[model samples]
Target: MESETVTKRKTSNETNKKTDSLDDEEEIGLKAKMTLINGVTVIVGAYCYAELGTMIKKSGADYAYIMETFGPFLAFIRLWIECMIVRPCSQAIVALTFSVYVLKPFFPDCQPPDDAARILAFCCICTLTFVNCWDVKWATAVQDIFTYAKLLALFVIIAAGLYFLLNELQDPVKNLPRAIAISCTLVTVVYFFTNVAFYTILSPEEVLGSEAVAVTFADRCFGLFAWTIPVFVALSTFGAVNGILLTSSRLFYAGACEGQMPEILTMIQIHRLTPTPAVLIMALLSMLYLMSSNIFALINYVGFATWLSIGAAVLCLPWLRWKQPDLQRPIKVNLLFPIFYLLATLFVVIVPMIASPVETGYGCLMILSSIPVYAVCVAWKNKPKWFNKSLSVMTTILQKLLMVLGKSNKPAQV
Candidate 1:
């Protein structure tokens, strides 16, 4: 498996991927990998490849960084996989989710029209593409506003939960003994992920989305603010989509500028100083994905694919140490750290596949499916002349067409 630095896709105020997580949280049953395996995985996996994330920051090019530690072929394959599948599909997933949330508020009584929602999702991607292409500053401003809105909404939910818990349970510690007993069963830090799923873990029904929470709250209490949950969810989801659009486009742009992708992808809008070509490409790919799959499918696929890169990166840590002994390290860790993480990552990835192959197998295939494309990309030099000519022609047309976004177009600085 090829790799990148980050596996967890660190969420912050700026990236509230709460929409997808809400669905995961709603899943019923306490079904999980054995407690022993899961517990060790929880601790070892927390900092998995964190050092490689640092390496990428220090080295600047994720692919180039990997090349320094490993070789060009591996780096190229990783970049190829990322640019071709991971990013676009990811953007599409987010837009699809945003569209679902956008329509959920109004269609509370029924399922959203798939065709209509797909169209709306496409429009959302198009709108965000233009937002990114119109100007970098304006795109950033939109992101900032959404980030704050997302955070505020998240805090509101948390505060509301805490309030309800306090009011309902006069002896809040009443279950402390039972909790401790259950905790003893898990026996260690493994409860980290399981603990978050505590509420829904044992539930029998599916946890489709945070819609469950909001709906339940409305049915039981807080009727006055019931409408607010849907509204805030829409806002937060929109913010997440915008943030992902901005970042994912930049990543594609950077890959192109570094020559890992076709030069046509290097275009920047002169009028707005933005990666207009990359932004549009992302939108096109996202829309294609929106037309094909639903939210949960995308989520499962993305999560499974991400771990491949993450696992590969963790495996690089020891190699990097010997390969670049003099490399400046403001912070360092023992070899055992990354080794444990690598094993933990494998356990996390493999155990689930074994436990529920039907669900995760498709995602694993999606990740591996990049290999054929990667072979074509890296072996373009050996491709037939006619194919090369056709590719060149398409590239030229796209370059000229996308140049409409700029007055004095320039290649990305890197």
Candidate 2:
């Protein structure tokens, strides 16, 4: 997620400042090249995802592709880790970033109180959750409006990327690749120039030392108008949170449809045609994670898991080709793309383990923890009828309360 890296960069900047001091010209040149390299690297994954998305035609981006190609156990583990750690933590961290920036102008010469920021973050999450749950159209509308808002902001700052919501596209197989190509190209150009602008305007030391790089850039260039930068960043991160919620809820809904999650999650509100249960559950989990002081640190660990899951999914591109030779492929990518993407994901997953063993260990432990959960809840399918009945009853009551009908019920189209 772009939002994941946005939060990760804050802490990383402090570390870079302490560890490496370089001359301004050398620093700017090095950082510019790194930005270009990073942009190219992301394109590889974008291609891989575009292929998998068209091939699978499912909502849960990585999870859906992995399940179809790798089978249930691995997919379930990915789903579990994503729901429990990656998605929620990423959302919370971004929400915190949003809150901080939204409150920045108000605080002016000082930082906002932690409690106040967190409270606002919670409200942001809840508001978006409601937007997601009440209607799919509403969620996308929020994504679109703020996306334009952020684009205008990015026009000012210059930066961005896109993914998820492929299933919602009318002609994903045809449109997906085009969207990826155009968006990735635009993002790559914008991000590279954005960094160039940063390096050109601010000294290397300032770039490395600042908490919010964009805010610092604005401080340097915007003068008294610097306050507008915070508002732009706040809008940017706010849209990011909505994008994450809009997509992550689909993972939960997809898991339910696959029988890996409670059946109720597969349901949609009758009137709204939205996955209310899935959205609410995701929102609740994100809210819980907001209470953790280690939310930023957890990004390091979850980054490990996130890349791992994505790597596994990308591997499926070739696996399915070899396994199911004649499966309908709306688009077939060259084998080289997935292979290169897998190598990139491998580098991503391994570097952290060597550099940050404790964080990597936590990520590994979290992935392994899903094993017992899968064994008990998923693998053990022969539960007593009473237990099954109890679940069905609860699902029924909740369905009534939420006014949702399971996908299996196939409520008539309006």
Candidate 3:
């Protein structure tokens, strides 16, 4: 679970942007070296998460760990930023990428139509949401199939580079770290070599200028087979959308489980035994986000808050070690892992302010906006009788409509 979850975190949609980012700074010559350095930094953070995931053993990922370590107040803030902005925006962006690739072949001479792409993206979200709400086994089955298909596409790219060079676990306590370590290492190598393949097939200027690096590489190297690239990319992004929905719904369910989110979100389908309400809410949010014209800008606007929340969660490692010396920890990372990861995270959140002040400012405001929301929805004890009655009635209606029961009911697993 951790391996697939972490691999999906390094979604393929961002691969081209990484090349563009390196070249945007006129550092094309050093892209390979910098990629290695960045990979090392990410591996350190992955280890930190592996340790935390092992200790907490919760579904919300960062949100779950934050709640355990930081208490409800701070946890709610992280939850707000994540559920309101990050997850939905990410799902929209990746789904849109999937649509664009799927439609690219038809519009060879031009960009895909926005309306068509968005409609396709909407359909993709709805399909994945239905699968997720139906059953966990079904979702994982989809994940497993697409994960392999995308990996084959990735290896095809890697093979073209050298024409050559070649390519989870039970007992999470002992095996989870190994799974995470191996997953991160493989991802880093694949990414690095894929970039090398791009550079090998296309010149530096070409790489910097091309809108879709993989497509361009395929055109250059796979002349008769150029069309396969778009198909491969579409499959990759579509699978990524499925993976994101699978994980993000769990985050919402975890929040509701702890009473941080609406009670409806904690309910699972009595028949399918899946988190139906939470999955539907995630799909609805992602669709709303797809309507935004500047989806990438929305991502930038939440970048600071995303890293900040993750850093806060990682910081909990050391704090917990000190605060609860006797807390059972099946896995404990070296203090240096969290120390380095926090430092990298600090650099991430702070540097963006100097580089993109407006977006960073908006990110800060978005996070701070949660305070008033927290005060009203979570913190304040007193509430009007009518408001409580309305909420209760709404929850009851939605539960029956969705054929779900609250966690308290403990519906039998299918």
lDDT values of the candidates? Answer: 0.61, 0.80, 0.81
lDDT by residue (1-414, candidate 1, tens digit) is: 223324334544226557544544444223334445556554454333344554456333455556667765666666755665677778777666667666766677776778877888788777878888888888889888877776565555556655654664565133533444455454453333332333433222433444444444433445666677556666666666677768765555555545567666656655566877777777777777777655666666666666666677566778878877776654456788778777766766786577667658877676566567657775455778788778777766766667633223442221
TM-score, candidate 3, is 0.85
TM-score of each: 0.73, 0.84, 0.85
Q: Compose the digit string of candidate 3's lDDT tens values, residues 186-301.
A: 98888888877777667788776765677778777788898898788888888888887887766777787777788777777888888787778778988988998876566776
> Model 2, residue 382: what's the lDDT?
93
Of 2 and 3, which scores higher on TM-score? Answer: 3
lDDT of 2 by residue, 319-378 (tens): 988999898878777888888878888998999989888878978997899999999788
**Model 3: worst 10 consecutive residues (lDDT sum):** 162-171
Sort by TM-score, top down from the best: 3, 2, 1
Cα error, candidate 3, residue 400 (Å)? 2.7
Error of 2 at 172 (Å): 5.8
Superposed Cα deviation of residue 207, candidate 1 (Å): 4.2
> What's the true lDDT of residue 185 in model 1?
50
Worst 10 residues of 1 by lDDT: 405-414
Query: Candidate 3 clashing pairs?
Result: none
